[model samples]
Target: MYSPALQPLFQSLLSTLADLNLAYDRDREKLSESMKDANLRTRALEKLKQQHHERREPYLQQLAILQDRIQRGWH
Candidate 1:
């Protein structure tokens, strides 16, 4: 039975993608909650959006790198 050593890379790619989706969902949920709360200010919403971008960027980069590696198809 031959297995490509790229399994870990594939796993990481899938996990990173799922994490990116979760981060997006969190951002949407936070915005929805903040929008519903009158006491929360516009600054709070802006901060949440910024936080989401900051958090998701690394995962986005990692996913791109992993896909690149998989595409290379190492022997």
Candidate 2:
């Protein structure tokens, strides 16, 4: 078994993941607005797309760190 201190850290990471997921969902909704009745402006859509792309690397890095901590006993 791992240290008890790791529990809170794990919880915090889980919370962070949840928040990130919401941010991702919000970005996706903005990207999808064009498909729906709402007209997403080209400039605005491009900006949002760029923002999402920029966030991709950091989010994936965080996910990888969390997964590593999980399988590697919080090393």
lDDT of 1 at 5: 74
Each candidate: what lDDT?
0.70, 0.68
Q: What's model 2's lDDT at 53?
A: 65
Predicted candidate 1 versus true structure: per-residue lDDT over 2-25, tens digit per residue: 137767766776787688679877
Error of model 1, residue 18, in angstroms? 3.2
All candidates' TM-scores? 0.54, 0.48
Candidate with top lDDT is: 1
Candidate 2 stretches with Cα past 4 Å from truth are: 34-75
lDDT of 1: 0.70
Can you tell me which runs of candidate 1 are displaced by over 4 Å? 1-4, 16-31, 34-40
TM-score of candidate 2 against the unseen true structure = 0.48
lDDT of 2 by residue, 1-75 (tens): 656766776677677667766897787676676555445456666776677667565756776776777688874
